[model samples]
Target chain A: MVRMTSFIAGLSLLAVLLATGTPVQAQQYPPVGGRQFPLNQMSPPGTAAQWAINAGRVAPNYLQPVRVTLPQDGKVTFYESLERPVELAAPAQAALLVGRMYRLKVTGMEDFPGVEFFPSIELIDRLHPPQGREEDFPIDFEFTTEEFEWAANGRLITKVIYLEQPDRVPTELLERTPRITTIEPSRNVLAEADDLGRPMAIVRLGGRTPDPHRPEPSFFGPGGPIRLPAKVTQASAQQRPDAVNSR
Target chain B: MKYYFLALGTVVVVCVGCAMDGNQHLNKGEYHAPPAAMMGRPGPMVDGPGPGVLPMMGGMGGPGMGAPMGPGGMPFGAPPQRPAAPSTTQIRFVGPDGMQIGWLIPNGYAENQLVAPARYNFFQGGTYRLKINNIPGRDSLTLYPTLQVYPGHPNTEAYLTHNSVPLQLTEEDIEQVESNNFVTKVIYLPDARYQELAIANVETLVSTRLDPGVDPIQEADKRGTIMAVLRMGNMDLEMPGQTGKPMAGTEQGGIDQVAYSVDGAQNQFMPPLPIGPAGQGTPGIPGAMMVAGSGMPGAPISGVNMAAWGMPITGTPIGLNGPPHLPLGGPATLQSHTVRNRSKNEIPAGVKDMLIDVKHDPGYRLPPPVSYIQYTEKHPVYSPGELSMPAWAQGQQGQGQYCPPQQQQ
Candidate 1:
């Protein structure tokens, strides 16, 4: 009863039937190219946390993981859930803060110098509640010549910017400077290499400093530089009509 | 609880160690570290050797404070843990000129409450002074200058003092105080941070003197000022939109019309010294020159014939008032218009300062600048009758029922 669209946008609105999971929606926007940030997803433990409702088909919990093919090659595991709601700072503008959370997963792919996707990240849509613009939000991860390569797999090449959303657009996010924080093998790696032979899969970013956290989409209009208005926070995702069958 | 007391004991030891090593030097940085107001000490009397409890003298001949006085009335020694100059707490005020006037100190509020006498009116405004007093939560604040102009007559002899300067003429005297009566206010900060000694560090000792190693936290030190700006005026008097929240519900007190520059500038007036000998007194006449002269007003002659002090004085006392309400000379409704169409036009320096008489609108008038407003807050209160319902409710008056009118009836 539902449809799932890939990373490519349809020239005209087309609907396809899905096996079960994915919701049937209109045309989906392509993912924005993104880079890895060094920020941890959790709070300081004892503090109260704001949570996000599960609306997407994939669940990025300890039990299950989603796999997606990268533009370069090799497989990346997406923990389609994990990240909860948080109030992050919208860069540049000293006033506004973020209302949504990144739907993240520490993937099992040599994330660097490769196209690793940051999926399910929902930007508080001005009109729609909980529904996300499709493919998943993408992050362009690059590697310098000095960085070591995975002897088995070829090096990765990233599309740093989304060709569609330039600096002039309202929802177009800003470019993040290429600076790597930390990268290492995932705890549960399918294959492990010691002689610096295999590419390390999965890297976590964002520690004490800034730099890596996703930069806000810059709005240049009217009075010099204007930032996007606060995302009208919606309570919960709409319940799927065929809830029992969605699983 | 036992650990807490032990920690207190350790604090005692470190305090002793610190006393031996703490520097007493006051002028090391910006603030006046040494406490003034002379205090007393249990010392040997000036003329006593016989066993008479040893008569003592004061620190100005009264209570000795944390730092002792050195040669030529300066505080001696340096504090052991004076923070770097930049990290020190700074006391700032907005002068009549609207510029930030600041004096950085290596300390915080003396105790949470800052009380001091003004040698003069406060030149600076805004957050007046940061204090480091001993009070908690509500202390560590400044006593703001009560901006009042002298209301009484100048002819009274009781007005002058032994020093001859008006008593209110403390260091930061405001020129406006020459015109009003008394101005007063009290503002307290609900959150003020301070150093608290741990209960355990009561007895530990390092080198027999007060030591940080003994009580670590308790033995630790911090500094603050005893002075504060207690009075709070219109918070947004300087910045726009600052008064919105406070101005919404409760009506504010009236403030006289003293229009500052609309484009964000302030007016300032320096003082003519108090009427005394060094000021206007004459030589041969004993006190005549100093007392009779106008703070030597016209002494420094200028090229301008305008009273030598750059003030407007006419043949028949111009620019001053006759009695109350009757504005002197004209209604100030006069305006001048100069037609210019060019962009980035030159004002031609002094030509702009020159007054060019213009025709008035006659019936047209403008109102004074600043106005008063009301404010409200969410004051939580409880009601007894409503036991079954959720007690915490919101209301404008802070009390009453939340149920529908029909249901209550």
Candidate 2:
């Protein structure tokens, strides 16, 4: 009888301990500030390749005016198709589709004799200029002398061109020369540019050129469509600065 | 039966007491339950005050005293700690144009010659006195400043690796310094939410520009991660008989005696050290070693007597011995060995068809590929008089200009 009573007391003690034990809940820390969403989850404003693939998802046929400025005298040739090429003088303006990537063959650069550069321009976003006056404030794709030298020396240079926010513009009068800031390669250029101002375009310059005889088709990319500006009349052309210089 | 009843009653009373105590603890608001997002998620947990325990009583097994009991008698662990900052940080001196920036070395002041738009890596978490001189168009004017570079934080990992902190003295800053007033500049990269502009740019908070009662450092902290702080005053650090001149063989005013030159010929500039969570190794820094194959082999199992007895080596073939001339070890004697299976089995009497059945639990479905595309293009229609062909297109054989058919009015 004494042994049975002691055994019953031990059984009740075990039951009490089991009932008092609580479930082990895991602990969690708050998400890092400004990183509520993972980077890959963000849409549209991403890498050049991502922008190219998803450019027309919102507006299929939006064209942004882009002006190509060379360091020196050079001709920019745009390919319409496999064999169709349209050549234009430097400081040329064209209507490029937003989100599409285009390639340009730059030749006759007085600085780099006998050398040609095939640079790519990716237009991820567009400008909203006044109606029919888009040419006045086209996105300037100027290739600086330093950038040209860097590209010629086999270094890959990626430049992100952005429009300055009106309110955040510096109070002092800045020079017409665009403010160019080079960041580390590991950092996301798109993200950095997006923080300062609206990124308009991305220009990638490398030393890769196509072969003369057996030129690769993919080197020219998909040859996205482009609309050239209307030809200038002979009377107006004569009044132009370049026309006068030619004379 | 009576003993069993007595034990059951004891357990019932204890459980009832625990329940009442838990209810009272919840009513007193001593315990704050974790957020819904944090609940059940595994991470670093912060211990809270135990039930019926006060924070002041932490010494007596209370909160922050190692696994404090939570509301339901659950023990919560301590919170996670922040990682240590890197030893060195690179600071870029952007320009006010023609201004010279120099920092104090060990023994003396490394004076002017480090012009604006130069970059140098400095030891982090140290306050260094600086001399600013040679201001363009402002001769005979100089300002002494102190720069404090804080350690890196988790929030600044990406920003510090990819971007350099830009320090520039604007015209207003110079004017303020000339007025014999103290100026405090806080250089920081604002958080994404606090960033007003689309492009990320380094922002500076000037003490003179802000409201009188506002603290620039505090405001900058609320806005973004602060990289460095510069406090400038009109005080002349290089006064005659002062501790600015180079002291030979002796430490002057707690500064080291080493001299650093701006040209970096005497003492090379400290390269920027990679920091933050990236774990990127610097160009010249060594990192963890990587072995190529399966690593080195273990010691041989054969005994020493095997060499003296002329026994075949472990790697030798089972029946082959080493070269007859050499006793210890040489090339194996076995040359060629082959294995073949000659046994065959009879074919079954009748075996012809084979069938397989596969069923997907969730069937794969896809939209049919696009078959037809309709494109409509709009272009300006020119009249016959207005239509003109370019010189290059006019001479081509099939490129002659033809006017489009006129549309009905």
Candidate 3:
């Protein structure tokens, strides 16, 4: 029994010594080639790929969430509402191929059925006769339905992303951009069409009474200067330098 | 002679008038202040007080301490000395539930790696307060768990530092450690340390490297040293193969969706996107655009310089989703615009994926071809406990965790 106690006591002492003697940091190794590894989680399952797929599956025809970069000075009209499509310029535009596809990306609007992009006619590539048909060619926006839905409503799309494809575009005209064909909207929306020349239509429409709160109270009110008296010019210095002429 | 005498009398009269005018200046009085040395000090206290005198309370008959009585004989208590304002150095610590508070001197062989001061340890565990003078009230410090592995499969455990007891790995702590891996203790710091870490760039001096041969504990004792670093990590245990496919709503899954950064450390992403030649200049090879300006890609923000880490090959930051060019899974991968340019050698041998130089044209002048270096990690390349210090400390520095020399001495 005494021997057993002694043995246990020795073991306990050893454990304590090991714990207290070697500092917590002493055990820290250089971490090179150790089991110690940074455990980064994989891309979440319902993230980009899944969300894109879900959005694509529900809509009849939708713009893939491919992020499209407009060429330098490139501008595209994003149809925020079916009533009117507002045009927004690209981050920057410089190299614009006359007939290449410039992709645009949008997000969070699975409810938005489709959009109309109206690029300037000059931005569109028109192949001369002999090279191709004279008819304006519509730009092809590729939608990936592979295991990963690469393109979703909000994905960034790029111009010249599809230059290598031989089927939709001719190899000789890879540098050229596709012409934009205007798609008319459903007739019920627009009674008198504006100069855009396309038939007026509305895909989605709804309105709500605004909240009781005033539109975010802005500090930027139109104002003449408050005419605050900055300094009490000791009544002695009230006269201006021109006062000498008056005297 | 009579004219000169009359002139002198007239001058005297004029001088007298001038003196009287000076004396009649507005608000003038005969009030005279005593000399500077005798100015504000009160007269010595009288032991026996009479009328208008304060009665002696004990022997505290000092000039500043004595209070004179009013006509009503009301004696004012030494203008109730305002309680000394709480010291900014006083730090408060609120411990986890059911935590037993103990004092931690933070003294050990690993002292260099720790940021807490080594002079004293406090036992009150619920919350210990330290006065952080410069730190804002909102300054928060996140404590990440350090992991330890045992012999058994799936035997990895995580433990967080507390003032309770010097954390010792034993059978008793196993369960607590396992449960604590998910518990990322976010403690608010007195603003002093918070501002220090917040404004410090990635390469700010957090820890220093200890010499290989020297003993850390001995060195610490020789110099009373203290060091603080922003310890950061995800709250989920994501051991590669063990963490299957991160499904949404799962702890790991949620973390995966969001980009990771050192909890409080500011991350800066500046990728010097190659400037393209304007409108149909000679179509050069897509990837070989001339590097414009002496701009290096993805430099660290704040004052911490990262010049030591060779300038990384630059890629444009696409939105806020982090540097898109890196092929997933690196220290800088998910951080906004931060990526470590890996040398050709670091590309693991037999890296399965093809290196594709895909040009990212986000509707702007075309960006240089973004080379995506793809590889897969069935397991993490570095330990979860190990943090990737700033790029400046990248190479074979002080064993991953850099501990600066003990400055306490």
DockQ scores of the candidates:
0.01, 0.06, 0.00
- The C-alpha stretches of model 3 lying farther than 4 A from their native spots are A1-126, A129-135, A144-148, A151-247, B1-409
Comparing only chain B with the true structure, the TM-scores of all models are 0.16, 0.43, 0.14
The TM-score obtained by model 3 is 0.15
Model 2 root mean square deviation, Cα atoms: 24.7
* Candidate achieving the largest DockQ: 2
Docking quality level of the chain pair in candidate 2: incorrect
Question: Which 10 consecutive residues of model 1 chain B have the lowest summed lDDT?
Answer: B155-164
Local distance difference test values of all predictions, in order? 0.22, 0.56, 0.24
List the TM-score for candidate 1's chain B: 0.16
Error of 1 at B14 (Å): 39
Docking class of 3: incorrect
Tens digits of per-residue lDDT for model 3, B323-357: 35566565544455454545455555786786645
Q: DockQ score of candidate 2?
A: 0.06
Error of 2 at B224 (Å): 1.2
TM-score-sorted candidate list, best first? 2, 3, 1
